[model samples]
Target: MHRLITVALAVALGLGAGSQAAVPFYDTYQLQCRANFGAAFNLPAGSFFTSSTPAINNAGQVAVNLVNVNVPGNPPGVWFGQGGTGQVKFVAADSNATIGSISLNHLGRAVFPQNFTSPNGVYFYDAPSDTSGLLTTQPIGASSFGTPIVNDLGQVGYRVSFLGSNAWVSFAGAPPVAFHAVEAALDAASPYSFLFTPSFNNSRQIAGKVRLGAAGQTGENRPDQIRIINPDGTFTIIAHDRDSDPNSLFLSFDNSVALTDNGWVAFNANLFPAGRGVFFSNGVETRTIAVNTAGIVSTIESFGPAASASGLVAFRAFENNTALRAIWIGDGTTLRRVVREHDIVPTDLGPARIDQHDASPVFGGSITINRYGDVAFNAALTPPDNNQIEWGSGIFVALARTPGDVDCDGDVDFDDIDAFVAALSGPAAYAAQYPDCRWLNADCDGDGDVDFDDIDPFVALIGS
Candidate 1:
């Protein structure tokens, strides 16, 4: 199985020889799924697969869950996988008594439970050194925490359910504050409202949803409304009326939200409550953006920073079962469908089934759109199994960033160009030392080369 995937990758790379600029989007462990490396890694017999709700840092470091390789008499422990090299490591010996949550920051640092909910044994893995630290050593005073999301600054926000109570975010040092649930009704039995961290930016701003009320309620129940909260304790709510039927029975709201360092918040909502596809971005003006789908599923299993200052929302969208799922990027006024997988060849692949709600075959994992409209997500592809189609399927195909290096980090865009010219002009050895700077940078002007044509922005930078 692994060899076949690897052969496919060899063919892909060979076919891509002409476009030296094209870089594969994903790196997967083993042959369980298709990734850039052509499926070299695989789980040992007793080792098991983890759900692909992966956490990715700005450094492209991703942390995924794993199960230990079972021996005749040994017990299983929780494990985490590294992105740079697909290295899977156990939290520690005696740490595998039970499984809990795992998180990784942009620096590739991780926090996990040595034992399920064992407050004192929470360990953080340093990506650089591959060392683990006891959470008790950190200043935060919490016995147990989960669902951690970290920014580039190493600021971690996690749901800490401490002392037999509800959960909230605890900063590294300060006393943990219970995250307040969004209250829409102000009065109702249990009211039933809550919010969790979906994505955060360097500015300390978080984009997430607030579920307000159950299905049938007075005035209307807004499930999955996009909201933003600042570090200063201020928040604004953004809701889209999808059903539009002033008296409709169901009120489907936008479930996905993302933010840019530049203070732009983007969301997909039912443009007029009639529930057609319309996007909304909050920058200088609060207005409807062009879109064709109804709305992005409220459940954004994965998310990343926005790719543009002009406010573009990128996400995977689907209509229902029996349809194609495509990656979508919306720049308020224009929408682009960037990536799609080929249909299964009945003779070679066999029949395919789709779930009703999601419609897509694979579970929706995390997604991040870089500043240039390049979208990244954990997608699925069938492995070459003789008969078994459903259970033996693998779901981790990463796609190349679209538009070819808009932000350019060896792979693509403005950022790559800036870094390339800065390195080249600074010292003679810059290009030689950082070959990726010269070779991997994006050629936006498309002059068949990534040289002076790509460095015009840098020339302006130097002159300024």
Candidate 2:
């Protein structure tokens, strides 16, 4: 069987040059919830997701924040759901307290902050145990806490603000530690302060943006810099606005930063004098993933870019000329458009147009991408009926097509052999033969291509 498969793969490669049809890159788009419509708890009338970014873990579990607009104070709540599953469940809600943004871990645990209960601070919800509890409160002398994120080890990192100073604190089953504080000196000449909300990775490293002056300094005097605080209390500066190297220079950085376990820092910033772009660096080398230019992106949104452990970065931006907002994924060399404003997507409720009204920075819905390249986001939808714009907001997920599932049956098996060959023949031929499946399913190595390098992995998956 292996010999025959190898021969078939060779022949398919020989035929690759014959076709050039476009193939779909993703396998599914799942709608977890829509305004007035959800598989779990029914949202209050006129409820919409607040300006909190959605979070997704490697396990494909997603958590998002919700707000009831009809309510006088716009009370908040948190909702949880899984990819490919239509069900969404209410994790927690408080009519009297406003819930902060949330972060999910591979263990299906979520962390957020709220003041509704006593000892108001960051809280955790364990999906497996179906229980919730307070993870930690404000550190001693800290007046408030915000932007809490949980890593796979269940450790929580957040920003703590005092009377006039701010610090980034991390908690691991003990009293939180302020790893970095405002007005701290990055070096002899750079008295960097004012840390932004940070991204935490399993390596115990926290990455964030900092201004290069005292806390209250504004404008160009306090230029932005990206730094990663290591586990041993040491830190590395990845990029600086004042760097003499033209490649590392930037006018300013967005407040958000994403850190991967491998130490890549992903962010978006304004280019000096003109243009904006998304970038990722390893503290030694910086790479531009996408930039604003004619016929390409016109404006890259300032909401921090999301980075996966595998080094892929995802961000929201506006397409050039058209000014259409879109969610994009890149691997530092190639970019793929995930979804765009006004694009009609298939939903369980039927086809709906992706309305950008609620996806703005003011409305929340920042993009989140996992290691598997799955992107989670919130958007307002216009149903096929074209009515009911008020009940249009929804949380949606785009599931990346799994490698080797060439037949698109949600699995890899013996039946996929012929379809796999067709996919290798070229996207055009593959689409002609299997119009419903993605040619990318043949990318068993997940290198963003269908080629001979995938044959061995494909065989192993079926053989196992």
What is the RMSD of candidate 2?
Answer: 7.3
* RMSD of candidates 1 onward, in order: 10.9, 7.3
lDDT of 2 by residue, 58-125 (tens): 76788876654345556666677775453334434456776778889889998988765456688877
CA-lDDT, candidates in order: 0.43, 0.71
- Screening candidate 2 with a backbone cut-off below 3 angstroms (N, C-alpha, C), the clashing residue pairs are 51-364
Candidate 2 lDDT (Cα, 0 to 1): 0.71
> What are the per-residue Cα lDDT tens digits for candidate 1 across 1-464?
33453343344334323321232232112212222213224333444433344444444455555444344433433333433235445534443454344556556676654445344444666778877666532324445454555555665544443333223343544444434332333224433344444445566666565555642343444444565666544666554343233542225544445655565666544434344344444533654443343443222223332334545565655524324565555555445545544433111123322111223445345445433333434444443332233333222323333323333432232233334544434334445555422233333344434444544543332222
